[model samples]
Target: MEIFNHNANINFLGMRKFSVGIAILLMIASIALIAVKGLNYGLDFTGGVSLVVDFEQPVQIGEVRDALEKGGMEHAIVQSLGGTREVSIRLQPKDDPASGVANGGKVNLDRIAEDVTRTLQAARPDARLKSRDYVGSAVGEELRSDGIIAAIVVVLGIGLYLGIRFEWRFAVAAIATEAHDALVTVGIFALMQREFDLTVLASVLAVIGYSINDKVVVFDRVRELFRLARKAEPEEILNRSINNTLSRTIITALFTAITMAALYFFGGPVVHGFAITMLIGILIGTLSSIFVASPILLWLGVSKQDLMPKTKDNPELARRP
Candidate 1:
């Protein structure tokens, strides 16, 4: 039934303040960068005409963009996905009201598609527009709302589950850790100008799930130590718990990171961003679960007595073993 074992727990309580300060500073930087540069949202959430084209041979993104431009779609976005042979084309409505806007002032999707396709075809005779779709601005707004709701629900669910499983304080610590990791990840994306799309959103969720799983493992040990070593100080118990789980955490995180790195390097365009983001998340999650979250619990005054059951001298549940 044992997943893994380790020799000692690392004492991070001594450095908790410094670690948290650095994380907060980085988060601030990330927010500033996002505000200044803005996010480069994808077509799915930005309302654009999407064209999927499969070429007879591998084609570069530059070539596709050039083709679309020559065909008269001068401001289209071209990206390759799945493989270099497959390309995704996106065209925003021209700002000029006379051409893109409707006769009645409604958004004109049909005309945009028609003009984009014509331009693409004219630029490359052999290039065929495999499929096309469009999302109105109203639809994009809906997607943004849904994505935010999903993230909030996930964090709240993790907090509730942890509170029930351990104690409210442990749950609080875990959620703070999750927030830390999320903010750090977003900051990196903002600073590096990484694409934040639906897939990236999925990756962020995955990171939260993975990071919390690690925290739960460590927290379980801390709770057990709390019950057994009733006289031990909170810092001692936390240090022991983290040290005991250190090896397992490192092994699992490094293993996951290695696999993610391999996917990033060799998995082609489809997985490059996802793998990179996951790799960063796992490493951050592991570090924060130990150095950041557990230590903060100490600062917040979490201790063995806080978790002890009290029902006017409560009875201890008998161990089945």
Candidate 2:
């Protein structure tokens, strides 16, 4: 199962300065992109009208999307509900200015629904409105706030767990790595102006979890090697640990990326945001585990003593390798 030699020595930490510089630059760029371009919040966050339309016969999603676009609903989010005959359409509240705001700045949901139905009927004579719903701006705002809180909580929770499981150095490195992965993942979305919705938010959180898992594996190896190597320096121990686990990390990321690619191509637009986010996160996370986390741990002065067992009963802790 090993893709690399069992006793490989690649000197990964030799390029620590270069890798760390690249990581810092990328993270800075990600932040800049997010701050400037901002995310293209989807129907779930921007508050919009949801419509379910039924046609007399099976129709292509592209055809429905085109019809809506021609009717001035270019930003509509269209997807198949179940079969080809049933389609779901989501439009931001601002799509139709005539029906967007009522007397006192309230969304005119009824008018928007009627307008959508009329537009669809014009395109297909038998197109019928199956259901209509509205997501208010207030609700979307609340969801956005809640999603931010959830992400912060998850990151903090991970830092706490790692602090307890390993040490403060590992915790700090893990936190930085996770933050880098999340920002880069989200930044790509903002750069591409991809729809940021509930599903995508979920994917970002999933990426944090996945990225940390990879780092923890490496961190675990580092601690083991530190304790086992009799007089190894922190850099030497980290390099050995990463090289030892290189095969596993690459293999895992390869298969996971392949699965995500399949999901992206076949899982339809409903899961596009999730699939794409996972794909980006995987690439960034894999690289960061090798280049980012270990370097940060080294810079934080992680040493054998930090991992050495303090128990007097364990004489092995003082034994030579």
Candidate 3:
């Protein structure tokens, strides 16, 4: 089946110059916001208490906060989970130097949680602690480092794989697209001050993987079109490639957005944030594959003649000289 027949042709090539300007402006703004406001890193990266509590009746967040305060646990973060029946609480560590550390100056989060739980039980008999987790500062630092390493590895792996399968240009294009998606996603998190946590890290990785999949699809098609239209200018060939795969790209993006929207609305608190981030990434990834990444490749002077070695001395006959 011919994918180009739908005329999903957006004439994006015509507006390519303007798209670059817009992307540059956005990138600058994103960088400035990141530097100024910073991300809202959660307890998963910084030491804090996380407790999941179940109650016999529907829970009210205000009442929980009040109860904790009454028990001398003021300034605790409390939010209802799933609905109003399950709730999670995070308590900030005490500022006192010795409150958290035990022997050898290691954080004793379990002890802190134990004390807090006992205090809460005495204040609110209805609150039943279902589960608890604590991340010490040392442990959180390790996890943060590991997450960064994983993201780097993923980007490099994609570059290497695509380079081997296609060409260095294609590989670079794919990795650039991945970085484009990640920076935009991270910029949004920083701008909005969303909690950066383990779940957020997972979503970032997922977005990287998803963005590359879309980019590689477009790059593969571009490579094919380069071969088919050996005489065409790079811009014309890229436009043709994008036009050809435009239908598939839009359909895939729409379907993914629909699924993610459902999860955002009904997937529960456990995954709601992750789903929202993925949804945003999907839209950005699709747009970047078409506008940002492809335009960069064109600007870089990619041509069909580069990928395929010369077979005939009269190859000039097949292309404009």
Best by TM-score: 2
Error of 1 at 246 (Å): 0.9
Candidate 1 — what's its lDDT? 0.78
The TM-score, computed over Cα atoms with residue i paired to residue i, of candidate 1 is 0.78
For every model shown, what is its TM-score relative to the native structure? 0.78, 0.87, 0.76
Q: Report how far residue 236 has shifted in candidate 3, in Å.
A: 1.2
Q: Rate the local accuracy (lDDT) of all candidates.
A: 0.78, 0.89, 0.78
lDDT per residue (tens digit) for residues 100-191 in model 3:
55344655667766766676667566667788876567777898899989998999999999888777877777777787788788889998
Worst 10 residues of 3 by lDDT: 98-107
Per residue, candidate 1 scores C-alpha lDDT tens digits across 187-234 of: 788778776777777898999999999999998888888989949798
Q: Model 3 Cα displacement at 224 (Å)?
A: 1.6
Q: Can you give the lDDT of residue 47 in candidate 3?
A: 72
TM-score for candidate 3, residues paired by index: 0.76
Q: Candidate 3's C-alpha lDDT? A: 0.78
Name model 3 segments beyond 4 Å from true: 1-5, 50-91, 94-134, 309-321
lDDT for residue 154 in candidate 1, whole number 0-100: 91
